[model samples]
Target: MASSRLYLSAKSAAALDAELMSSGGFSLDQLMELAGLSCAQAVYKSHPPESKRNVLIIAGPGNNGGDGLVAARHLKLFGYDPVVYYPKRPNKDIYNRLFTQLSNLKVSFTDDVNKAITETDQILDAIFGFSFQPPIRDPFVQVIRLLESTEKPVISVDIPSSWNVDSGPPKSGELGAAFMPDVLVSLTAPKPAAKFFKGRHFLGGRFVSKEIAKKWGFSLPDYPGVDQIVELPADNEKL
Candidate 1:
């Protein structure tokens, strides 16, 4: 049988996001909060604070990073010791507010990614989203390399860092098999790249409205009562 799920293209994803804010009457902050909270819930369900208490969040410089910051706050509240390593902090008001909120929670921000990774039990890769392009730059190149080398479980938000949102990971490169995540929490909907992810997949971002669903021609799975996320079966061909 043909899969009922829909995997969005980068363009459609961006359009859907804009429509959510405009037509769906949702704010960016509202969506990010839900997305982050869902990500945290997914982590809690799969890894649990009892097993992976110390988490290292590797944040980038865009909305994906903001999602990471938000996830860090929620994870801490969920009884996980979450630390943040934000290499390129954006000078936006929303980001500043997120930074302040995490600070108030006594969440440590580290300048040393190496030390942070070594100290944590798991890692959250929120460095890039569907908007990311090729040619990984400074600071992040080293960061991705470290992520590739680590033995700890990694849960990537949306699309994994450096991955082509539609084509998945690089077909032939150094950042291949080793960098694959152990878990993935896809927000709103899974990107086409998710078809290649060979880990425990999850769907978060539960704010999609029925109208939006109809407009996009996709149907979401029914989430269990009060749950923020639902695990997706690993069927590459179906995705």
Candidate 2:
């Protein structure tokens, strides 16, 4: 993970997350890949694809759902047949475009989250983005409960579902009341909530950063010290 502290308050992070969706960073579909790839790297680190393990992705209705769909598509590209489960029908136009892309890739989508959970080796929680609205009920709550029961390792994109990224975790105070994701994949910068409230469970990495060449391990084309234009050897010297 590229380590550089780009600070932003939870509120700011949420705002940026929202703004980036609107800005042409690369359309909503591309932002989905940005968010999804961040989580996918964590999954790859934990469970390498060569092992042939199953990954279950829980998608919500909004852009969060788009992130999971993006991840599922990438996982398929990486040779992992991830099962994607979204409880509600996707309502966003971006999500619809993503659904079409996933269909083109032949990735499976289902509403049967229970079955998806039952069979996967790893679970990815992509249900909620940074924004949190209250009155957590039915399908989402039930899905959270099922995930709690499962012993599989879980990765969450942005914040886990049923938890407010701003105010903190859920307050139902049940046995597994508050949301806890094993790995929390953050984009661009770390959210304040993930730093202060989330404690040791938080793990963040950026999607893309401004740069070129070899400042760090990553190499970029035409980067300052790297791939600098130089004169070719003279014909006599070549001999």
TM-score per model over all chains: 0.95, 0.74
> Residue 46 in candidate 2 has what lDDT?
59
Tens-place lDDT per residue, model 1, 66-135, is 9999999999999999999998998999999999999999999999999999999999999999999878
Residue pairs whose backbone atoms clash in candidate 2: none
Backbone clash pairs for candidate 1 read none
lDDT of 1 at 10: 89
| Candidate-wise lDDT, in order | 0.87, 0.63
Best by lDDT: 1
Model 2 bad stretches (over 4 Å): 1-7, 18-26, 172-178, 196-239
**Residue-level lDDT for 100 in candidate 2:** 86
Error of model 2, residue 188, in angstroms: 1.8
Per-residue C-alpha lDDT of model 2 across residues 73-125, encoded as one tens digit per residue: 87888778788887776566777777888889988877788888878888888
What's the true lDDT of residue 229 in model 2?
17
